[model samples]
Target chain A: MPQRMARVSWRLLLLGVLFCAAGLVLTARLAQLQIVSHGHYAVQAEDEHMGMEKVFPPRGAILDRNGYPLALTLDTYDIYINRKVWQDEKLAADGAEALSSVLGRRPDEILAALGPDTDGDALVAGSIGYDAGRKIIEMGVPGVKATATIVRFHPEGDLASALQGFVGRDQTGLSGLEADLQDQLGGSAGTLYFERDSMGNPIPFGYRQLTQSEPASDVRLTIDRYIQEATEQALDAAIEKNAANGGSIIVMEPKTGAILAMASRPSFKLSQLDLADETKMELYRNRAVTDLYEPGSVMKVVTMSTAVDLSLVTPNTTYEDTGMAYVGGYAIENWDFSANGTTTMTQLLQKSLNTGAVWVGQQIGPERFYDYAKRFGFGEPTGVGLGGEAAGTVRTSEDPEWYPSDLATNSFGQGISVTPLQMITAVAAIANGGELMRPYIVADVVGPDGSDETQPQVVRRVISESTARTLTAMMNDVVEGTPSHGARVQGYHVAGKTGTSFISVPGGYAPDRVITSFVGFAPVSDPRMIVLVKIDEPQGERLGGTVAAPVFAELAPKILSYLGVPPDAPALVQQGG
Target chain B: MSALDRLIARPLPRPFPRVTGVRPVLVGAFLVVACLGLLQVAQTSSATTTGYNLQRLQDERFATQAGVHQLEAEVAVLTSIDRIDREARGRLGMVPAGTALTLEVHKQPPEQQFVPLRFLSETKAPQVKTSSWWQRLLNLLPFF
Candidate 1:
């Protein structure tokens, strides 16, 4: 080629300039993405190849005092269906039918949950056992994935269902101790971050950020497995024998305010519970702590205690009982609608005489009466460390509905509502030397490292020790004086009172419906345990002595012996006495 | 001097000249490259091994945790008191013990009692001789 005078072509120059400018722009854009907005882009990249998952820590176990498990967490799988693939394949088998065989679900139900046209990870089944889940995983089913989740299981079935309670699908406590101590039982969740390789498997030793989860602590309740079973069995027998609708029983260590056992009928097992059923939902509330009723003449325990503590009456104190006493234009009549001339305080408690309770209330007067009621922890919650607790209703002089007749009725546990917990706790004060204790069921919070123990809390001293002794002695006379009343326990000087109050209807009171209850303690000398048995609407025998007292009489001996307490009476009752 | 001698005289082959800077430098470069290549290979192999080991360990940890939870749940179900009672009564045809005559055991006379040997000096150290678990631990001990 000849060296010719080179002419600079403007077109070539323009093209060169355009190329340089384009390269510069590309470099600048690369810098912006890789540097200026690096964190944002890095996050996006992580979202693509990296995965983030929630790691829920294991929930704590609820144990009985003897380290027996009440409620515990188990690992179960949530079976997810790759529905998109199923729909794409129009899966050869009816998926519902296929899964129904393995899952025990109705075909129609399964189909509704896993419809043929569904997309993405649809839940096919939940809470499948580990062995079953593994089998499913090994089946290599293309359209199925199994992920583990936690489920609550009660080892003892319905033994203490209402007390232990259940957890919901979201892994949160829903009721009972489960709800009350959620923070202690439910631990903090954590996140697991990792990058995946080409096969969609997490890359080992590659860019992983893990925040460890803390396991939830375990709860140790004061409830004894044996005592709880005994109470439930006794209550069940009582309900059947009395032909009662339902009932509640509370066994407490009066000395420590520890609820050894609390049981209620119409309870459902955690495993059998179906939240969708409204009828079963009512049984979820622990009636011992939640339900309120006219506690009947059990209020006499408080009434008589008030009078005895005030030195206004003794066991031998007498009151005149006219057939019907008129107060605030209301006639107060006994159950038999008759009079027992002049009644002694001991006879009043044993007979559950309404007339005598009114006279005692009259002697105490309104000011002292209301003050004693407040002192006995009536009209307020017992603070028993349960979820649904009720404060008993009382009409004091301060309330507008105060009636002179109300005082007469309230004396015998009418025109006032109370829970089984409150009644027992009040009577427990007398059993515990008149010191009101805040009742507690949970004994300790245990963990891998250590345990946090629940101390016995005394709310306050309600009455003098001497008063408690007098009342206990007087209560003992009630059981002994009236042996046919069924309050007497063999080989023990039992101290207790019986109560039967009418259930109020729209107007006055139901002729048939009545709440019959017995509140008492055993081995009256040491007073190891106080028991409350309340039966709702006993069929034939409407009186507390007939319906409720026998329950205590039967269960007390077994309970006392089980607790290793020597009897205060003859080793064996005198036969045919 | 003889003409033959002059023809045969090869000046004693100039002693081979001493090799200096250039050749040595070239050889050094080759050696450095080889060493670097070997180091890179070792690093890559170690990383791959570490990654595989991490994966295996992670799987093992998960499996163990799952196993522990499963066992806990199983124990709870089996040890349930109601089940035990039912099995005892229904399957075994058992009954609650009736009242019985009480008996008490008194301590033996001192002459009949055998006292535990008191060792002034231990002759042998207690060791796990048969257990494989202990043997495996022994394998980890440098002194063993």
Candidate 2:
């Protein structure tokens, strides 16, 4: 009986040992899962259930020199589709159709945009317009989603359109001042991450993460909005009055190289950019700095200035005009084809006598004349910070195409091409005491907190102070004298040159087709501002003095008064001069 | 044993006597823990409110900056030269007339010229005395 009892006890003990071994194994497994591999399992769970996404921050604003908003970023909604959320193909199609109806896009196009052939993670629907996007969001389509994006807005509409330029849908600057200062204007994007609920809505207090977005710095331009509007108005009027192709107007503070106003006609509104309008897109080209033209009699100013500066001729020096001059077997005639005998240098300029300019060019010689032209900022970019600037064509003396006829024609502003900005900036140099100031549109880059970095640059001194003063005096006589009496503005002394260049077509020079241009500074006694107005291919009167000069006369007084510059001279006296 | 039991035994309570001190101490400890938890919740909620307020204030600051910029741009456009010219030329019927006058003069005594200068003290001394009290009162009132 005792042996049997001991055996029973041993059997019990064995059962107990088995139970203990099972408990030890279970504890080891629990330790491995709960402690050793906790992080791994936690990460896997997060990946399957929770999602985090980064949101981009707002871009910067563009301001004028005095803190006027020229370009700005406004929050806009972008509609998108989640294909996975759609219950079926038909539901997705219905959602797309509904979105397309509001977006003004064809149903097929919207379907294609939302179709599942995308290489990206999400299928994209068409970007709806702001109004449409807002309305669609209100409709509350189940699978449709909306994201906020920053879009560039120009508040003044088309004012300074060509200079201020436009940005693409991607928020990148495409042209003009915007393109040049894009880096400074485009601020760094910020990131935001947060935990989302089951409905994919951001939780108010769940794992909130934010990186403060550095808003883009504001780009302050030298352009005065008021002056820009005036310039556009004047240019439009001139274009209409002449019935010309198009026109450009530039106004600059000669002393500082600050472009107060720069305008080009046939411009497009930034808000209405369409890909199909090729002609309108072409009009966005800043002709003042992009398109090259022969400056005509305006070139005479440079020649005369060079001669006078070199002491080759004085204002009182006489040159006998015999209707025309024979050079390189070609006859270069005056505008009227009639000459007054023994005209002084001053009278020659006032009358825009081609032969007189040729005589002056001869005195300057070819090498020195070309050198002076280069010094005046011709045949070079003004470095005005606008993209697609052309450094006008200057036929070099060493080129195989060089001819004596080229020199003779170039003397009177032909056989050479120059952009209007180049001509105006060069003239500005002459008006501003021969300092070739680097013309710039963007004056400074300001931060969101009003701190700023200004890039005010002065290129070089092109001519001596004395020479510049002398040239200003001569140009004063040209505009104030009898022949150009029409260009005289009341209450101001205008120093200007009129250019009537014939357009070279397939045949010789185009008949009745001319580019009439007037470039000058008002209150010439202390030239504060310089202006240039050009009219292309006027139908009726094509004379620079008749067509372009009067425009200058009309605009100068208005601009002067607007700038708060009191008349240097009395109104009636200025008109009489 | 019966006689000893009778001698040692007094009246005993019918139900088991309840322990008083230990129960109260445990209850008090539980209450203290509950109070601590409530305080923690309050502190966390206040911190969250402060954070929300800070965020709201930042948003307001940004909005104000945008408004100021917008108004400044409007002012610039309104005060632009072109608009002024339109008003002056179209509405005022003004044209630029260039007539200048030069006053030619012979040399005169340096001190004999009439100078347009006014002594502020002499001009407004009585007025200043009359308004001094009111000015001081207004200065003392910050809102005014």
DockQ (Cα-based) per candidate?
0.17, 0.10
**A1-49: candidate 1 lDDT, tens digit per residue:** 2223233456667778999899999999999999999999998887889
Q: Distance from true position, residue B102, model 2, in Å?
A: 14
Which model scores highest in DockQ? Answer: 1
What's model 2's overall lDDT? 0.77
Going through the candidates in the order shown, the clash numbers are 0, 13
* lDDT, candidate 2, A363-480, per-residue tens: 8888999998998888888888788999998896877989988888999998889988888888888888888888877777777678665455667777778888878888898887
| Candidate 1 ranges with C-alpha deviation above 4 Å | A1-50, A90-113, A131-143, A196-207, A571-577, B1-48, B97-144
Off by over 4 Å in 2: A1-57, A83-141, A191-212, A276-279, A448-457, A506-508, A571-577, B1-144
User: How do the predictions measure up, each by TM-score?
Assistant: 0.80, 0.71
